[model samples]
Target chain A: MDHDSYSDAYLKGVLEDVRTIAVVGASDNPLRASHFVMKYLGDKGYTIIPINPGQAGKEILGHRVYAALSDLPEPPDMVDVFRNSDAAAGVVDEAIAAGARVVWLQLGVRNDDAARRAEAAGLRVVMNRCPKIEYQRLFGEIGRIGVNSNIITAKKRPVKPTKKLI
Target chain B: MSEKKSFGFETRAIHAGAAPDPTTGARQTPIYQTTSFVFDDVDEAASLFNLQKVGFIYSRLTNPTVAVLEERIANLEGGIGATATASGHAAQLMALFPLLSPGDEFIASTKLYGGSLNQFANTFPRAFGWKAVFADTDTPANVKAALTEKTKAIFVESLANPGGIVTDLEAIATIARDAGIPLIVDNTLASPYLIRPIEWGATLVVHSTTKFLSGNGTSVGGAVVDSGTFDWSKDGKYPALSGPEPGYHGLKFHETFGNLAYTIHGHAVGLRDLGPSQSPFNAFLTLNGIETLHLRMERHSTNALTVARFLESHPAVEWVSYAGLESSKYHALAQKYLPRGAGGIFTFGIKGGYDAGVKLVESVELFSHLANIGDSRSLIIHPSSTTHRQLDAEGQTAAGAGPEVIRLSIGLESADDIIADLAQALEKAVG
Candidate 1:
């Protein structure tokens, strides 16, 4: 997100302050981006609250999936908007109503009006970037696809060459 | 792949480590449940006690039935030998204990199970003064970056629990070789049926039989398998194997037992002191669990793919993150490491925000909200609150478990039924 004052550091701060994230629009499809992103983030350490109106009352990642942010047991640190640009505004409205301190839009998902509204309400706004990807990158989790490269392609490790038979 | 004597995994599962009772003609290996074995007169007893004779003198040091399970797993893993332990976590500890000592260190993957993270970050540091540093296990560079002068091992799970992210065993093994240490892989998720870390160059393998190994979850056990690939006597780096042992009256393990000494010491010293021996019942259950390992693992992978696909297509889903999916960044790695199929777990984000997520979980029908994984029945959890709750907010994000994520471990149930259950649950969540 390229908001003038909103920096990656600021987004990181929001991510840092977020003890738990309510992921709206969680999908079950293996091919969908959100499914793995949720698992990735969940694996990293965030308590992911899976939100999908279509899958309400079902558990995802062992947590209850609420239909709306208003139905959660308590206010979460951030309400991650995973819906389309069109549906994002409504989610942000609920996020504001739920007393969430931040609203993050996933990568390729942006709504200026929603960002404006969320920013206007004093909630942190991060648009078009995944917390999972950002976390890995910012925290050095994005090491080179450093497997079997036989060379230190990732993370700048010095690679020793194997001796060839004479 | 060895042509010595081929048998089906089932046949090998039962009879690999055992021999028929010569006197009674019993098919099963008898559980020698005595604490100490009686010797025939003085000479035989002296040889046995002195480690000169290859025989069992005590259950704490060795047991006939436990030995059978260890052998069977060794054969299954294509490893040289194996050691059975009280728990999977204990297996990991024993595997490294012989290679490292106080003031020494090891490099580990950050993607390790939380208990292991706790074991390395807090427990091992406090108890043994042996330090462990964690790097992002997903990337080999991070693991290499974490290495230090005192480091002796690079440890990771073949298929990390909960997330089911398969580690690049060959890559990690290469690093271990370069670092002159062992690559100890916890092969609990894939089991022997799905993938063998040893074949991929892992120096040692460990398992938690409580999970898929004991498929029905009826047992609590662990095993450590030595690939016997690393020669401890090569550079004198390992004193435990090269140096004389006071416990055994200055008998060097490599000189005496050669390839098998590591397993021998795990029993002779590790188990005896730690007293982490598995019970006969749990071992038997795990043995039974092995019978259908191949079948269960296949079904699990198929079901997981189905569930992941369903979550991806749904309007409520913001993204799906199974490596099996073409869109996943880990897809290539999964293809490289887990060619047969990726294991059964993955996570996804929900659409409506936090409250919608709470409703969705409450609406699920068949999926159990539990803290365990690799069960026959599907399991789900929101890690930020449940498993990794102790981690502060920043730690959570660093661990890949940001809030707004839900992890699912698919089960062996029919794929369609599983999807339908999630479907109705999603419908209920949104409505």
Candidate 2:
């Protein structure tokens, strides 16, 4: 539970293992970063249960909203917190209570105390990172943006959709 | 990295798409000059080809340097994404490629660059079987009337070339919205510094980066910015986006990418097949030019206003068609859309006619007699004899390039120097 950088293997493992993501502070507004991330993850074949207290009964990007992580129909595999650091502590506590295997704090939403507490509860933690960007990066998508992806090959390959069990 | 919405235009222009080279820590964006990138493995290479991952495969498809330029332009224009191409003409073609198939029609403004006119009237219809019905967009009714079941998009320029006519973008956008088609605005002359077309309800914006966006005229490049607002999947009309494609295992782009469908398709399919890709070096130069866009555009606007005013008062000038001038028909529209100033290019009729227009071009010492606009150096052209010479008299007038007209692209020189140079040239032509 050291607060050092997570390796590519660790990130890729987390992404492959997680099935459902509960996006805290999700909004219906398309301009919001949370909304875009929810839509992107959903398109990538992840089950997204949007968590926004203000929009508990409504729908965002075709997913029913939950008032909080506790209100979800079932425990999410990963709790992706989009709220600020102060709000993130409460969300991290909820993630532990809900028995989420991984607690992910989105870009700029980091709290060391929360990370420590999550680790104490035996939960894997990712802080201050976007899951969508990471999924593309680890899976060889970021190479499109000119980032150096360590993998290199001359042969063309078809992308098979990742196996999903909903 | 924080979202770019918090940054100012100037700050975004300098840093939006650019970050220090991850490998070298080089502050400047390095030109990844290679034709192809080495894929890490067969699976990684397959993922890139499948569009399952976003990474460089080929230079004709995407380059890192060009990607930065695309990101910067999209940031400046307030779009979701962008695709950079070989030239402005290519950008126009790319913008319409996915939307229009054979026998489909699109409404266009008559007040467009003559080159665009030729492409739309001649090339598009003949080669692709796509027809462009030009409507006088001075009235919004004409745009609305031009719409038919076959129409897919409504195209116009924010500020018409040569004549400096500022379009009533809001009114035209309303027409485009009612018709449920994307508003494709060619913002080449205005350069986002004067106006952002997306703010006025444009679905997509195109730019001739060869002009003011490059600022120095050192490179020829173009960009297409997707607003990500239009719902291409709503109607069955846009099949290329909504329907499954044969290219990538029946992948529906709109369903897959959501807001980024058009731009993603432009990169994945349009640029991939057309091979009209901008060079990484050109993108690097254009990115450098954009850093000083705010400063250059301001000076260009102010200098243009001074020149316009001087020409309006000059005895040798018959009329000036600058939107910045109070007497211009497009003055009110210009104020609403381009409050900064009415851009740096405009046309004026000389006292004597076509011969005097030619004389004026020959007499000017400081202003370069050339076909190009939006350079750091002032440029003068008698479009009837140059850029629009291919068009007939009726076509010339429709494109706003009459025989007596002389187009001027005001530069960032001293206002007094620009005025003095024009005045001397005018006297030589008329005397």
DockQ score of candidate 2? Answer: 0.10
Give per-residue CA lDDT, model 1, range B316-363, as digits (tens).
Answer: 888887878887777887888787788787878777755666677778
For candidate 1, lDDT tens digit of each residue in A1-166? Answer: 4553344457557766887889888875532456646665664567889888898998875778888898988988888777778888889999998989988887657888888888888888887666755664344222111001011111321211111211
Give the best candidate by DockQ: 2
Docking class for candidate 2: incorrect
